[model samples]
Target: MVLVTGIVYKQVKEQTCGISFHRDTLYDPIVISRIRPDGLFASSSLAVGMQVLTVNNVPVDDMTSSEALQLIKDTVGQVSIVAENRTIAVAEAVCVNAAPLVPESRQKRGFIILKQVEKSYSFHGPMTHDMVNLINNNLRQLKLVHGANMLQFSLNSSGHFYGATNNAAQRVHEEDFIVIILETMELLGWCLKVQYDRSPGGWQKELFVFHRMSE
Candidate 1:
């Protein structure tokens, strides 16, 4: 993982017990260097050496990384991301693979994670015990979503995860494709949104399914 430097930090304050309190602050924005091949991390057009200073043309200095990520999620079509200290804009692109898993039906259920920023995709078919173990094993190495029984994990190549859909996360296999899941306030980093056609059967009527990726 490539760490972008030049991050500035300061301190903030609070009041309690008729006294004032201050705490050191940490503000660092997450930028993508690559995308997870089979996960919600989709293909991006952002080139190497590009420093992201803003999202959708908004300067990021005053906003938190999460906030900047959300701004990216809300935009579409050649969304702008600036270089770290440069005044020029960088290129932005995204791509998704096909998925092997079929939409759930009968008693089966399906889940996905969406990037409110670029709306990129990664789809998963079924979660197995072994897959869960593998994801847990590499949790620390993973950029964004990691841990157990993840219904959905969203992150760009840069490794920023904002929220989860089901909250029950499952580990993903190297070949399994998965979808991006999300909503308005809880935009999952810098992807726009998950877009896919629906299957004819399975799943709850109120829910929608997208083909995130394929192995």
Candidate 2:
């Protein structure tokens, strides 16, 4: 996203061809990732075992290790990367066709939280920080307040970034992720948050949702 510190539509001979928008970063070569469940397009760049620590200007470093992990799980969308030199504009993020969960799904929905216990298959390029940008950017588009629980989501997200790892079998660490599922007993009309132990090399299970129940 292109960020102009000054007023909008102001003429800057330097950015002659560019027009300013709001204070937010704007994209030129807008990039989008693959679509995942919940109408979100997950980032193709995101890989499992990747640890993200920040989004845009938001720093997750100050957060507890557990808190940081949740942020990525909850967000969906892309980010804007402004070149230091202002030579170019790029929306480097995971783009999604994201929409709100359907009423049926929401009624059925709940939340889950996962912690990264291992950093097994780190990609050659793009660290968790890069993925953070993508995650944060995606969240911005959704207009959702993703705090520590940002990435704390359902089982659908597991395989998306998992297969990309070369050593998929050995990638995850012991107790790498704490899996929690929110299941809706349709007959009972109540949601159940089921906590499970995620084995080192296995993926999380299905539909049981993971959204937090509000106070």
Candidate 3:
């Protein structure tokens, strides 16, 4: 059976989700090879071997790697890219309908964190010191101390960008990211400072849910 995910709204200007793919065995399920700090659409739910079944509900199984790649690259504004595990059931392609998990922060910044994917983006380089400074500088300006607001600091692990939640257990090299963690403890829970990982090849997982737990 074909599964369909919900329609989400565009949160960030560029959904620069740090996810990249490859099909080692034809369209044998597009492999999630790299998820950098840039690809915000990628979440923990989107792991390494998840198979991409469709792009916006259109099956990509018949297309060439380049063609499928282009299709994924071309998606915009709340488009869904569905994927599932080959060894698993069709019911598990969570990426298919990325509507609900995706968050948008227009008007005023809400408590939710947004996933910004840039399909046509290019990596700046071995992430540089200047870049780290800039990232920290900009994130510092967010004034995340206002509310239960949060931002996920996407750090590069190996070649991929893993979220702050996942990087703790991996062999994460500090050289890949700015070495600083922002925290605040207030009557209104703890102050959690967040920043988007701009380095290419990073994945943005589901919106930060730490706020709920804090409450």
lDDT of each: 0.30, 0.25, 0.37
Candidate 3 structure quality by residue, lDDT tens digits, 19-100: 5555434535664444454345544455544667776678888774445655544566665667665454212211231121
Every model's TM-score: 0.26, 0.20, 0.34
Instruction: Write candidate 2's Cα lDDT for 1-215 as tens digits.
Output: 33322111212212111111111112222221111121111222332222232433455445543333233333333332121123222211211122323334333334323232233211111113333333334433332222212222211244322211123211221111211111111112322233232444564322222233332
Q: Judged by lDDT relative to the true structure, which candidate is superior, 1 or 2?
A: 1
Model 3 / residue 32 / CA error / Å: 1.6
Q: For candidate 1, write residues 87-192 as lDDT tens digits.
A: 2221121222212222333212344332222222232433333333333344334243344332334443644333232222222211111212211111211222
Worst 10 residues of 2 by lDDT: 16-25
By summed lDDT, the worst window of 10 consecutive residues in model 1 runs over 15-24
Alpha carbon lDDT of residue 123, candidate 1? 28
Q: After best superposition, candidate 2 residue 23: deviation in angstroms? A: 32
TM-score of model 3 (CA atoms): 0.34
Task: Supply candidate 2's per-residue lDDT for 45.
Answer: 33
The C-alpha local distance difference test score for the whole of candidate 3 amounts to 0.37
Best by TM-score: 3
Tell me the spans in candidate 3 whose CA falls farther than 4 Å from its real position: 1-15, 25-27, 86-215
Give me candidate 1's TM-score against the actual structure: 0.26
